[model samples]
Target: MDSEESRCFSGYDGNRFKLVILASQRAHELSSGAATMVDRQGDKNTVVALREIASNQLDLSTVFGLAVQRCRKYLEEFAGSRGIAGHSSHVSPSRSSRHTGLGKSFVDNKSTYSASFLDQDKFLSGGKDDGIKGF
Candidate 1:
């Protein structure tokens, strides 16, 4: 306990929780492509974080703010790139048809989504569904 207590920094004022959060956030950021502010002689994230915290290279405000910014950026990118189209979920047949060689023979033969399902109004809920009429 003596060594652990002695190695502690005055910046945290003995707040172990704050130290842990700061270190963990820094470590996460480091793992997510952020460069280390401290020199790391093959030290892993925990060691780097601890060294940064001990030397006051990291701060609580920066950690919390970075987390929020990264989260927002992730969500924006997520909404931006939802599918292969990378545009909208409701893809029209004409727009989707542009994707050439999408296993047309395989899809037509092996799946229920055959050529019969291509009608714009047939699949929609507006008209009466004549079951297997197109088949």
Candidate 2:
């Protein structure tokens, strides 16, 4: 697979199959066979983890807890923005009376071109051949 696809697969946090595909792609790009072997091991670990999560062998809370722990680690490593944990209680404005803009102004419509056909013809011709020369 392409590098973009591999990156996307690596970024996937949802499924184990996706992770395996991504890891495989990365493994394939390795110059040394040793790196490929290491990737295979990682892929196997991901598969095992996925199976444990899927077969009810692992508790849902435990899975979520692990995910949260990993997310915390990532957050600490990246020092990125944290997510909100509580529900919002703020009142929303009524949809019908919602303010759109400050005010409306009546714009006067005007035509820049002259209405006379002769003026239009002259303007269009650039004062060159005025159709007098027969083809």
Candidate 3:
């Protein structure tokens, strides 16, 4: 390995395995159109990732956190597409429609509920109903 590559371990607190994993993940990001943190200098994505790590330019926490968020969003969409309800068992069903004065069974009305599920921001914000109905 190049001296820079060897130095990459320091970025992960001397954890060689973590350095490798994080570098590969960063390389994947580069290939997926993420901007490089270090100058490209005609180097491959893997090399750029290693250099960024070696120079301590990469934010490791953000890398791991973004991956987690992407996985969570994917799982939520997958569950919703499969007609699965809320992923958490602790949140009572009544909470989903509490502001609308609709009973828990309101979610069972697919015609009305589907729109809310698709626009999760509005549904989750707990705003008052607009007093309107779909035609």
Clashing pairs in 3: none
lDDT of 3 by residue, 28-119 (tens): 89999999888898889988888887887877766655544554576557557655564334335576546454423333442343333333
Q: What TM-score number comes out for model 3?
A: 0.44
Model 1 C-alpha lDDT per residue in residues 1-135, reported as the tens digit of each score: 235434666434443544565577788988888888778878888777788767766665667456545544654564345432323344457855896544343233323222342332343222445232432
**Model 1 spans > 4 angstroms off:** 1-12, 68-135
Candidate 2: where are CA atoms >4 Å away?
1-43, 80-135
> All models: lDDT?
0.55, 0.33, 0.59
Give candidate 1's whole-model lDDT: 0.55
Name every residue pair that clashes in candidate 2.
none
By lDDT rank, best first, the candidates go: 3, 1, 2
Question: TM-score: which is higher, 2 or 3?
Answer: 3
Write down the RMSD of all candidates, one decimal each.
19.0, 26.5, 14.1
lDDT of 2 by residue, 1-135 (tens): 335335544643443433333333333334223222222343454443433333344434433434335444553443223221221122133522364321111011112112222132332333454332331
Q: How many pairs collide in each candidate, listed in order? A: 0, 0, 0
TM-scores for all predictions: 0.42, 0.27, 0.44
